[model samples]
Target: MYFRLEDKESYKSQEIGNLIRAYNRSKREEAESEPLNLYVEDEKGNLLAGLIAETFGNWLEIEYLFVKEELRGQGIGSKLLQQAETEAKNRNCRFAFVNTYQFQAPDFYKRHGYKEVFALQDYPYIGQRYYYQKNL
Candidate 1:
Protein backbone atom coordinates (compact mmCIF):
# COMPACT_ATOMS: atom_id res chain seq x y z
CA MET A 1 0.00 0.00 0.00
CA TYR A 2 1.05 3.59 -0.64
CA PHE A 3 0.08 6.90 0.96
CA ARG A 4 -0.28 10.23 -0.83
CA LEU A 5 -2.07 13.50 -0.16
CA GLU A 6 -4.80 14.45 -2.57
CA ASP A 7 -6.00 17.97 -3.33
CA LYS A 8 -9.13 18.88 -1.40
CA GLU A 9 -11.18 19.06 -4.58
CA SER A 10 -9.77 15.93 -6.15
CA TYR A 11 -12.02 13.08 -7.25
CA LYS A 12 -10.27 10.68 -4.84
CA SER A 13 -11.06 12.95 -1.94
CA GLN A 14 -14.73 13.06 -2.88
CA GLU A 15 -14.76 9.31 -3.37
CA ILE A 16 -13.31 8.83 0.07
CA GLY A 17 -16.09 10.94 1.54
CA ASN A 18 -18.64 8.91 -0.38
CA LEU A 19 -17.16 5.69 0.92
CA ILE A 20 -17.39 6.88 4.49
CA ARG A 21 -20.96 8.04 4.02
CA ALA A 22 -21.85 4.73 2.47
CA TYR A 23 -20.36 2.89 5.38
CA ASN A 24 -22.28 5.06 7.81
CA ARG A 25 -25.52 4.45 5.94
CA SER A 26 -24.92 0.74 6.10
CA LYS A 27 -24.56 0.96 9.87
CA ARG A 28 -27.61 3.16 10.43
CA GLU A 29 -30.83 2.97 8.52
CA GLU A 30 -31.67 6.59 9.33
CA ALA A 31 -28.40 7.99 8.04
CA GLU A 32 -29.96 9.62 5.01
CA SER A 33 -29.13 13.32 4.75
CA GLU A 34 -31.23 16.21 3.50
CA PRO A 35 -29.99 19.64 2.62
CA LEU A 36 -31.45 22.61 4.47
CA ASN A 37 -30.29 25.77 2.80
CA LEU A 38 -31.61 29.30 3.16
CA TYR A 39 -30.80 32.55 1.42
CA VAL A 40 -31.69 36.23 1.65
CA GLU A 41 -31.83 38.15 -1.60
CA ASP A 42 -32.82 41.63 -2.64
CA GLU A 43 -35.61 42.63 -4.93
CA LYS A 44 -33.15 42.49 -7.81
CA GLY A 45 -32.18 38.93 -6.75
CA ASN A 46 -28.83 39.95 -5.31
CA LEU A 47 -27.85 37.64 -2.49
CA LEU A 48 -27.28 39.37 0.84
CA ALA A 49 -26.80 36.34 3.03
CA GLY A 50 -27.02 32.57 2.92
CA LEU A 51 -26.85 29.45 5.06
CA ILE A 52 -25.84 25.96 4.04
CA ALA A 53 -26.71 23.03 6.23
CA GLU A 54 -27.95 19.47 6.31
CA THR A 55 -30.23 17.33 8.41
CA PHE A 56 -29.55 13.72 9.21
CA GLY A 57 -31.33 11.48 11.66
CA ASN A 58 -32.23 13.79 14.56
CA TRP A 59 -29.54 16.40 14.04
CA LEU A 60 -28.90 19.41 11.87
CA GLU A 61 -25.31 20.17 10.92
CA ILE A 62 -24.63 23.74 9.89
CA GLU A 63 -21.89 23.96 7.32
CA TYR A 64 -21.67 27.64 6.59
CA LEU A 65 -23.38 30.94 7.29
CA PHE A 66 -22.26 33.95 5.30
CA VAL A 67 -23.45 37.51 5.11
CA LYS A 68 -22.35 40.32 2.87
CA GLU A 69 -19.72 42.39 4.64
CA GLU A 70 -21.65 45.56 4.04
CA LEU A 71 -24.76 43.92 5.47
CA ARG A 72 -23.17 42.67 8.67
CA GLY A 73 -24.71 43.86 11.96
CA GLN A 74 -28.00 44.35 10.12
CA GLY A 75 -29.69 41.19 11.51
CA ILE A 76 -29.64 39.39 8.16
CA GLY A 77 -27.49 36.60 9.59
CA SER A 78 -29.79 36.23 12.58
CA LYS A 79 -32.80 35.95 10.33
CA LEU A 80 -31.16 33.29 8.18
CA LEU A 81 -30.14 31.32 11.25
CA GLN A 82 -33.61 31.53 12.75
CA GLN A 83 -35.18 30.38 9.53
CA ALA A 84 -32.80 27.46 9.28
CA GLU A 85 -33.49 26.44 12.84
CA THR A 86 -37.23 26.58 12.24
CA GLU A 87 -36.90 24.47 9.15
CA ALA A 88 -34.74 21.95 10.96
CA LYS A 89 -37.33 21.65 13.67
CA ASN A 90 -39.99 21.08 11.07
CA ARG A 91 -37.82 18.29 9.67
CA ASN A 92 -37.98 16.65 13.14
CA CYS A 93 -34.45 17.53 14.09
CA ARG A 94 -33.92 17.90 17.83
CA PHE A 95 -30.41 19.35 17.82
CA ALA A 96 -28.13 21.47 15.67
CA PHE A 97 -24.35 21.84 15.64
CA VAL A 98 -21.90 24.22 14.07
CA ASN A 99 -18.22 25.10 14.27
CA THR A 100 -16.66 28.48 13.92
CA TYR A 101 -13.24 30.04 14.28
CA GLN A 102 -12.25 32.66 16.83
CA PHE A 103 -12.25 35.24 14.07
CA GLN A 104 -15.70 34.14 12.92
CA ALA A 105 -19.14 34.43 14.55
CA PRO A 106 -18.84 32.57 17.86
CA ASP A 107 -20.66 35.31 19.76
CA PHE A 108 -23.33 35.42 17.11
CA TYR A 109 -24.11 31.73 17.61
CA LYS A 110 -24.09 32.23 21.36
CA ARG A 111 -26.53 35.10 21.02
CA HIS A 112 -28.80 32.72 19.15
CA GLY A 113 -28.78 30.32 22.14
CA TYR A 114 -26.11 27.93 20.95
CA LYS A 115 -23.86 26.64 23.72
CA GLU A 116 -20.18 26.26 23.08
CA VAL A 117 -19.44 22.59 23.69
CA PHE A 118 -15.77 22.49 22.74
CA ALA A 119 -12.90 24.75 21.88
CA LEU A 120 -9.60 23.87 20.20
CA GLN A 121 -6.93 26.45 20.71
CA ASP A 122 -4.01 27.14 18.42
CA TYR A 123 -5.98 25.58 15.63
CA PRO A 124 -4.88 26.12 12.00
CA TYR A 125 -2.44 28.69 13.56
CA ILE A 126 -2.68 31.09 16.50
CA GLY A 127 -6.48 30.98 16.72
CA GLN A 128 -9.23 28.88 18.19
CA ARG A 129 -12.01 26.74 16.77
CA TYR A 130 -15.29 26.53 18.64
CA TYR A 131 -18.02 23.95 18.38
CA TYR A 132 -21.51 24.91 19.41
CA GLN A 133 -24.81 23.13 19.74
CA LYS A 134 -28.43 24.10 20.26
CA ASN A 135 -31.54 22.18 21.10
CA LEU A 136 -34.35 22.72 18.64
Candidate 2:
Protein backbone atom coordinates (compact mmCIF):
# COMPACT_ATOMS: atom_id res chain seq x y z
CA MET A 1 0.00 0.00 0.00
CA TYR A 2 1.03 3.62 -0.51
CA PHE A 3 0.07 6.77 1.33
CA ARG A 4 0.11 10.46 0.44
CA LEU A 5 -0.96 13.65 2.19
CA GLU A 6 -3.75 15.51 0.43
CA ASP A 7 -6.58 17.81 1.33
CA LYS A 8 -10.00 17.15 -0.24
CA GLU A 9 -11.93 19.21 2.25
CA SER A 10 -15.22 17.75 3.58
CA TYR A 11 -15.07 14.50 1.62
CA LYS A 12 -11.67 13.58 2.94
CA SER A 13 -12.62 14.51 6.48
CA GLN A 14 -15.76 12.40 6.41
CA GLU A 15 -13.90 9.42 4.94
CA ILE A 16 -11.24 9.53 7.65
CA GLY A 17 -13.88 9.95 10.34
CA ASN A 18 -15.75 6.90 9.11
CA LEU A 19 -12.56 4.81 9.05
CA ILE A 20 -11.58 5.78 12.58
CA ARG A 21 -15.07 5.28 13.99
CA ALA A 22 -15.17 1.76 12.55
CA TYR A 23 -11.80 0.93 14.05
CA ASN A 24 -12.57 2.43 17.45
CA ARG A 25 -16.09 1.01 17.70
CA SER A 26 -14.59 -2.44 17.80
CA LYS A 27 -12.53 -1.48 20.85
CA ARG A 28 -15.00 0.82 22.66
CA GLU A 29 -18.58 0.79 21.52
CA GLU A 30 -19.57 4.14 23.00
CA ALA A 31 -16.67 6.48 22.42
CA GLU A 32 -17.99 9.90 21.49
CA SER A 33 -21.41 8.56 20.62
CA GLU A 34 -23.23 11.68 21.79
CA PRO A 35 -21.77 15.08 21.01
CA LEU A 36 -22.98 18.29 22.63
CA ASN A 37 -22.97 21.95 21.80
CA LEU A 38 -23.44 24.72 24.34
CA TYR A 39 -23.94 28.31 23.38
CA VAL A 40 -24.88 31.71 24.74
CA GLU A 41 -26.80 34.38 22.89
CA ASP A 42 -27.20 38.09 23.38
CA GLU A 43 -30.52 39.88 23.87
CA LYS A 44 -30.79 40.20 20.10
CA GLY A 45 -30.34 36.39 19.80
CA ASN A 46 -26.90 36.68 18.27
CA LEU A 47 -24.38 34.12 19.45
CA LEU A 48 -21.86 35.42 21.94
CA ALA A 49 -20.02 32.25 22.93
CA GLY A 50 -20.21 28.55 22.20
CA LEU A 51 -18.56 25.24 23.00
CA ILE A 52 -18.58 22.01 21.04
CA ALA A 53 -17.66 18.95 23.04
CA GLU A 54 -18.15 15.21 23.29
CA THR A 55 -17.84 12.50 25.85
CA PHE A 56 -15.62 9.43 25.60
CA GLY A 57 -16.29 6.97 28.42
CA ASN A 58 -15.93 9.20 31.50
CA TRP A 59 -14.04 12.08 29.96
CA LEU A 60 -15.16 15.17 28.09
CA GLU A 61 -13.22 16.55 25.16
CA ILE A 62 -13.81 20.18 24.33
CA GLU A 63 -13.30 20.44 20.59
CA TYR A 64 -14.02 24.12 20.13
CA LEU A 65 -14.81 27.17 22.23
CA PHE A 66 -15.28 30.62 20.84
CA VAL A 67 -16.43 33.96 22.19
CA LYS A 68 -17.11 37.17 20.36
CA GLU A 69 -14.42 39.84 20.49
CA GLU A 70 -16.81 42.33 21.99
CA LEU A 71 -17.65 39.92 24.79
CA ARG A 72 -14.13 39.04 25.77
CA GLY A 73 -12.74 39.88 29.24
CA GLN A 74 -16.25 40.11 30.60
CA GLY A 75 -16.42 36.59 32.16
CA ILE A 76 -18.74 35.30 29.44
CA GLY A 77 -16.21 32.70 28.37
CA SER A 78 -15.72 31.67 31.97
CA LYS A 79 -19.45 31.30 32.53
CA LEU A 80 -19.87 29.30 29.36
CA LEU A 81 -17.04 26.98 30.36
CA GLN A 82 -18.52 26.51 33.80
CA GLN A 83 -21.91 25.68 32.33
CA ALA A 84 -20.31 23.11 30.01
CA GLU A 85 -18.51 21.52 32.91
CA THR A 86 -21.73 21.34 34.87
CA GLU A 87 -23.42 19.57 31.98
CA ALA A 88 -20.48 17.20 31.62
CA LYS A 89 -20.57 16.38 35.28
CA ASN A 90 -24.26 15.69 35.01
CA ARG A 91 -23.40 13.19 32.27
CA ASN A 92 -20.98 11.49 34.70
CA CYS A 93 -17.86 12.91 33.20
CA ARG A 94 -14.98 12.73 35.68
CA PHE A 95 -12.46 14.72 33.71
CA ALA A 96 -12.32 17.15 30.82
CA PHE A 97 -9.68 18.04 28.26
CA VAL A 98 -9.26 20.82 25.73
CA ASN A 99 -6.63 22.07 23.32
CA THR A 100 -5.84 25.71 22.60
CA TYR A 101 -3.22 27.45 20.55
CA GLN A 102 -0.48 29.70 21.95
CA PHE A 103 -2.13 32.76 20.50
CA GLN A 104 -5.44 31.72 21.99
CA ALA A 105 -6.76 31.57 25.53
CA PRO A 106 -4.38 29.20 27.32
CA ASP A 107 -4.38 31.47 30.35
CA PHE A 108 -8.15 31.60 30.32
CA TYR A 109 -8.45 27.84 30.56
CA LYS A 110 -5.83 27.80 33.25
CA ARG A 111 -7.85 30.26 35.28
CA HIS A 112 -10.87 28.00 34.83
CA GLY A 113 -9.00 25.11 36.58
CA TYR A 114 -7.47 23.41 33.53
CA LYS A 115 -3.84 22.38 33.69
CA GLU A 116 -1.58 22.11 30.68
CA VAL A 117 -0.73 18.50 29.96
CA PHE A 118 1.22 18.81 26.71
CA ALA A 119 2.45 21.34 24.18
CA LEU A 120 3.23 20.92 20.49
CA GLN A 121 5.26 23.65 18.89
CA ASP A 122 4.98 24.95 15.32
CA TYR A 123 1.74 23.08 14.79
CA PRO A 124 -0.45 24.19 11.87
CA TYR A 125 1.63 27.37 11.84
CA ILE A 126 4.29 29.15 13.90
CA GLY A 127 2.60 28.91 17.32
CA GLN A 128 2.21 26.16 19.90
CA ARG A 129 -0.83 24.00 20.60
CA TYR A 130 -1.46 23.38 24.29
CA TYR A 131 -3.41 20.42 25.62
CA TYR A 132 -5.03 20.88 29.01
CA GLN A 133 -7.10 18.77 31.36
CA LYS A 134 -9.12 19.17 34.53
CA ASN A 135 -10.52 16.73 37.05
CA LEU A 136 -14.19 17.26 37.56
Candidate 3:
Protein backbone atom coordinates (compact mmCIF):
# COMPACT_ATOMS: atom_id res chain seq x y z
CA MET A 1 0.00 0.00 0.00
CA TYR A 2 1.20 3.51 -0.79
CA PHE A 3 -0.03 6.77 0.74
CA ARG A 4 0.83 10.26 -0.44
CA LEU A 5 -0.13 13.71 0.81
CA GLU A 6 -0.72 16.54 -1.63
CA ASP A 7 -2.00 20.03 -1.05
CA LYS A 8 -4.83 21.48 -3.13
CA GLU A 9 -6.21 25.00 -2.88
CA SER A 10 -9.69 24.15 -4.09
CA TYR A 11 -10.08 21.26 -1.57
CA LYS A 12 -12.95 19.94 -3.66
CA SER A 13 -12.36 16.29 -4.33
CA GLN A 14 -15.18 13.85 -5.05
CA GLU A 15 -13.02 10.83 -4.18
CA ILE A 16 -12.45 12.00 -0.62
CA GLY A 17 -16.07 13.05 -0.23
CA ASN A 18 -17.39 9.66 -1.35
CA LEU A 19 -15.05 7.86 1.05
CA ILE A 20 -16.33 9.93 3.97
CA ARG A 21 -19.95 9.49 2.92
CA ALA A 22 -19.59 5.72 2.84
CA TYR A 23 -18.07 5.65 6.32
CA ASN A 24 -20.77 7.97 7.62
CA ARG A 25 -23.48 5.70 6.25
CA SER A 26 -22.01 2.74 8.10
CA LYS A 27 -21.99 4.71 11.36
CA ARG A 28 -25.56 5.86 10.78
CA GLU A 29 -26.64 2.27 10.52
CA GLU A 30 -24.85 1.43 13.74
CA ALA A 31 -26.74 4.18 15.53
CA GLU A 32 -29.60 6.22 14.17
CA SER A 33 -28.78 9.91 13.58
CA GLU A 34 -30.97 12.87 12.82
CA PRO A 35 -29.70 16.21 11.56
CA LEU A 36 -30.71 19.38 13.36
CA ASN A 37 -29.96 22.87 12.16
CA LEU A 38 -31.10 26.07 13.83
CA TYR A 39 -30.29 29.71 13.25
CA VAL A 40 -31.29 33.17 14.36
CA GLU A 41 -31.99 36.03 12.02
CA ASP A 42 -32.53 39.71 12.54
CA GLU A 43 -35.61 41.64 11.47
CA LYS A 44 -33.85 42.34 8.17
CA GLY A 45 -33.38 38.57 7.70
CA ASN A 46 -29.64 38.68 8.25
CA LEU A 47 -28.13 35.74 10.09
CA LEU A 48 -26.94 36.49 13.61
CA ALA A 49 -26.23 33.19 15.31
CA GLY A 50 -26.87 29.54 14.64
CA LEU A 51 -26.18 25.97 15.73
CA ILE A 52 -25.76 22.85 13.64
CA ALA A 53 -25.97 19.50 15.32
CA GLU A 54 -26.94 15.87 14.97
CA THR A 55 -28.77 13.64 17.38
CA PHE A 56 -27.56 10.07 17.45
CA GLY A 57 -28.77 7.39 19.80
CA ASN A 58 -29.24 9.28 23.07
CA TRP A 59 -26.72 12.02 22.41
CA LEU A 60 -26.54 15.22 20.45
CA GLU A 61 -23.30 16.31 18.82
CA ILE A 62 -23.07 20.00 18.08
CA GLU A 63 -20.93 20.53 15.01
CA TYR A 64 -20.96 24.34 14.70
CA LEU A 65 -22.16 27.42 16.52
CA PHE A 66 -21.53 30.88 15.21
CA VAL A 67 -22.58 34.39 16.16
CA LYS A 68 -21.94 37.54 14.17
CA GLU A 69 -19.25 39.72 15.74
CA GLU A 70 -21.61 42.62 16.46
CA LEU A 71 -24.02 40.33 18.30
CA ARG A 72 -21.59 38.83 20.76
CA GLY A 73 -22.16 39.18 24.52
CA GLN A 74 -25.80 40.11 23.98
CA GLY A 75 -27.25 36.67 24.99
CA ILE A 76 -27.82 35.67 21.37
CA GLY A 77 -25.43 32.79 21.68
CA SER A 78 -27.16 31.55 24.78
CA LYS A 79 -30.56 31.81 23.17
CA LEU A 80 -29.40 29.85 20.14
CA LEU A 81 -27.95 27.13 22.34
CA GLN A 82 -31.07 26.93 24.45
CA GLN A 83 -33.22 26.50 21.39
CA ALA A 84 -31.02 23.69 20.12
CA GLU A 85 -31.15 21.99 23.49
CA THR A 86 -34.94 22.14 23.44
CA GLU A 87 -35.03 20.46 20.07
CA ALA A 88 -32.55 17.82 21.11
CA LYS A 89 -34.64 17.02 24.17
CA ASN A 90 -37.68 16.65 21.97
CA ARG A 91 -35.72 14.11 19.95
CA ASN A 92 -35.07 12.08 23.16
CA CYS A 93 -31.46 13.07 23.50
CA ARG A 94 -30.15 12.67 27.01
CA PHE A 95 -26.80 14.37 26.52
CA ALA A 96 -25.19 16.99 24.31
CA PHE A 97 -21.55 17.44 23.29
CA VAL A 98 -19.42 20.00 21.47
CA ASN A 99 -15.81 20.91 20.86
CA THR A 100 -14.25 24.36 21.15
CA TYR A 101 -10.68 25.58 21.15
CA GLN A 102 -9.02 27.38 24.02
CA PHE A 103 -9.08 30.70 22.17
CA GLN A 104 -12.68 30.14 21.21
CA ALA A 105 -15.63 29.94 23.60
CA PRO A 106 -14.50 27.21 26.02
CA ASP A 107 -15.42 29.30 29.01
CA PHE A 108 -18.77 30.19 27.51
CA TYR A 109 -19.61 26.53 27.09
CA LYS A 110 -18.50 25.83 30.62
CA ARG A 111 -20.88 28.50 31.86
CA HIS A 112 -23.66 26.69 30.04
CA GLY A 113 -23.20 23.57 32.23
CA TYR A 114 -20.95 21.61 29.86
CA LYS A 115 -17.98 19.94 31.48
CA GLU A 116 -14.74 19.20 29.74
CA VAL A 117 -14.51 15.52 28.86
CA PHE A 118 -11.24 15.66 26.94
CA ALA A 119 -8.51 18.14 26.06
CA LEU A 120 -5.90 18.05 23.34
CA GLN A 121 -2.97 20.35 23.97
CA ASP A 122 -1.43 22.53 21.28
CA TYR A 123 -3.76 21.40 18.59
CA PRO A 124 -3.81 23.25 15.23
CA TYR A 125 -1.36 25.74 16.83
CA ILE A 126 -0.33 26.90 20.27
CA GLY A 127 -3.83 26.37 21.62
CA GLN A 128 -5.93 23.60 23.13
CA ARG A 129 -8.99 21.81 21.84
CA TYR A 130 -11.64 21.02 24.44
CA TYR A 131 -14.46 18.50 24.21
CA TYR A 132 -17.42 19.18 26.45
CA GLN A 133 -20.67 17.46 27.27
CA LYS A 134 -23.77 18.18 29.33
CA ASN A 135 -26.58 15.99 30.53
CA LEU A 136 -29.87 17.00 28.96
- The clash numbers for all candidates, in the given order, read 0, 0, 0
lDDT of 1 by residue, 9-82 (tens): 88887898999988978887766689999988999999888999999888999999999999899899999999
Query: What is the lDDT, from 0 to 100, of the residue 38 in candidate 1?
Result: 92
Clashes (candidate 2): 0
Query: Which residue pairs come into collision in candidate 3?
Result: none
**What lDDT would candidate 3 get against the real structure?**
0.90
**lDDT tens per residue, model 3, 25-109:** 8776567789999889889998878899999989989999999888899998898889889998999999999999887899999
Among these predictions, the greatest lDDT belongs to: 1
Q: After superposition, how far is residue 50 of candidate 2 from its true place, in Å?
A: 1.2
Better-scoring candidate (lDDT), 2 or 3:
3
TM-score result, candidate 2: 0.86
Better-scoring candidate (TM-score), 2 or 3: 2
- Each prediction's whole-model lDDT (CA): 0.93, 0.87, 0.90
User: Of the candidates numbered 1 and 3, which has the greater lDDT value?
Assistant: 1
Which pairs of residues clash in candidate 1, taking residues 3 or more apart in a chain or in different chains?
none
Best by TM-score: 1
TM-score between candidate 1 and the true structure: 0.90
